[model samples]
Target: MKSISRATIGLTSSVSVLGVVLLAVLVYCCIHFWQAKQQEETANRALHAVEHLLLKPTSEYSPEDVKHGLEEVLGGQGRTQARVVDSRGNRMFGPEVFFNGEGSIREFSQVFETELPQLQAKRVELAVSTVDDERFLNFISGIFASSIVLWILVSVLISMRLIRLVLRPINRLTERIHNLGPRSLDVVLDDHKAPLELRPFIDGFNRLLGQLRENREQLKLFNSNVAHELNTPLSSLTISHELLQRRKLIEGEDLQKIVGDHLDELDRMARIIRSMLFLANANQGRKLQLQPVPSLRQLVVSVAEYLEQLAEDRDLRITVKSDATVEAETELIKRAVSNLLSNAIRYAQANTEITVHITLEAERVWIKVSNEGPTIDPLKLNRLFEPFFRAEEGRSDTGSNHGLGLAIVAAIAKLHGGDVFASSENQVTVIGFSIQTKRQSASG
Candidate 1:
């Protein structure tokens, strides 16, 4: 790829070319105007000299004398020619007016009736050469050409220098980035100290670095959590298997119970692996199979009914309110709603009401599940949707809640072109998500 310096220099050169062309045109116009004015003044001077010669009585000066006076007035510069002629087109005096050089000429003529009645009307014609003016114009043009060439050279050198100065910050940034390793992700670029033009780039880079740092930390935490979660059940299964192998004899019912426990542990592991895979795919932006659900309220009600037993266990009553129609992936939306309802049921106060409210707006359908429970810490509330992130109160006694519920909900919401939100205040926690309605989804 071409360097920015070269690109900038090329652009400067193009502009200089245009400026030089314009300047040359202006100079040419000025020189042409000066030449025209000079020619006019020369004509006026010759005319004045001819008038003076005519002031003498016609008898006092012969044609030859008038010619001589005209010659003296016009000078012997070989640039001007003058001749006196009769009205009959016959030359009266003065040398033959002719030119052999290649140059422009201006002609002036004056017809006068002399006092000699016998003499026909005489005409004075003057031809002025522009070869001297052409030579001067050539000299000026040469100087301008040389100056333009020099200016272009100087401009290129200056442009290169300025480009270097302009790109110095970028070069420093590049070096800083080059020296960075994964362990050094905490380092941040100082945008405040950077030039205004580079601040946006610096700020963006700093934000990216921050995100990388955050992701790295989350990855470490996630790995640790995964190991802990899997290790508990694996250890139990291993112990059960080892005990069975060591037993010399075992009763049939006892064997059956042990096998059942093993199956349960295996199921839990399967569920964890499945949830992790689902999240991985979701993060990769896997496409959803979408369809129109005529009644969002009904969907929530179905999810609530499915989990009614769990709510009953907590002595909580699940109630769904409002109605909305939305375009969504049915299974994923159901999963998201189920997760919200399950989470609410887990934390809801005994004998309290858990409400699922569905609101239909112009473009979106919001599903909110609010339950009376201990207030979630405001600082950790936002992070509840991140995988493996859970408040102290959220550590389930049954070991079935793996803290991936809300994360899955968030992923589903994103798939449906929405997001998840949670807020807890006054012993009431509301967790919900929104999905685009049919019209909105179609237009989008």
Candidate 2:
């Protein structure tokens, strides 16, 4: 199997089509000229025979004698005939019959007068019949066939050369691609010199390369952030354990407090690890097992109930408004809702009501949590869901939340084929996610 480039295929096909057209025109012209030449030859021969019969003087030759001579000269040829008639209505030369068939005929008449005798004018007519010539047709057909074969051979040779010429740029591009390596990942094909058809593909490939580079940078930052997050608790634990070991006599209450603090730090680390693992699974395109919920409002109400105590601590009230049903993993949906509700409670002003609004449409179920809080900077709204990202700017009050709450919400939404969104305006912050539902309405 020989491989061919697009340029070669295009060039060869064009050449082949043009060659076939030219060959047809050549065949038509050759046939026309051959037929015309044959007709000309027939006409010329008839004229010459008529001239010969007219030159003879009637005094020396009688009509019968002329007729015999005419027969000997012209009758020998297969399709030629002649006739001679005098004023007395006498048949002078050959038969007085005209050719009566479906073939070409050339007629010539010559008048001559008898000399030194009756001096009467005689008219001699020559009719040459041109029947279909099989041999001539065969010869023309053979010429046409030979020309076609020759043209095909010549066209193939020319097309091969053109193919190579046309494919030179493509061969260069292939070599360039082969030489590319990891070190040249940022490099892109130069589309300016590429064929018009390949530019779109080149552009798409360049865009993919840009995305991969961005992802690589994000991964690097993520790893560094993970290390920083884990190191703080581990260092504190080491210091606390060392202090307990070195102490000769530690107070009872203080000892219990230190142990409790150690456990809390451990628990925080565990939560972070679990959240990170969940995010990893979601990014890997894992599908969650979904259970249908009859009413999303009831689900939100249940999640709100569990977080009501925390909301009250900040003097905030929790409210739920829903008109949606969900088909999702029950546990995952609860976790997502809990994260959003918890965030709202943490940030909402004291004595304000945090609203969890659910809207169910034909094709999607939307869960939005809004609260009255300090206005979040518009610039950081999109990045609020990033792991370890905090809008508080490293405030220690975040506690065991560890900045993974919103991240978990995003991951769960993605796992359910949905997305998370956040916006803030005039001290009112809203964060939500929408998931596709199995059932769709007529409008959807």
Best by TM-score: 1
Per-candidate Cα lDDT values, in order, are 0.82, 0.76
Model 2, global lDDT: 0.76
Tens-digit lDDT string for candidate 1 (313-385):
8899988777776778999999999899888887789999999888766677788999999998999998999
Candidate 2 lDDT over residue span 1-444, tens digit each: 546754565566567757776776787677767765765676567656655655576666776675566667656256667666777868755664666544666566666654424324376666666445545566767776786677767766777777787777778877877887756768878899888877897788789878877777777778877887888889889999898889877788998899899998899788889889989888898877878777777778899999889988999988877456568888889999999998898889999999887776567778899999899998889789888788887757634568888988888888888888899999999999989878532211
The positional error of residue 331 in candidate 2, measured at the CA in angstroms, is: 2.2
Q: What C-alpha root-mean-square deviation, in Å, does candidate 2 show against the real structure?
A: 7.8
Residue pairs in clash, model 1: none
Residue 123 in model 2: lDDT: 68
Looking at model 2, which ten-residue stretch has the lowest summed lDDT? 112-121
Task: Give the top-scoring candidate (lDDT).
Answer: 1
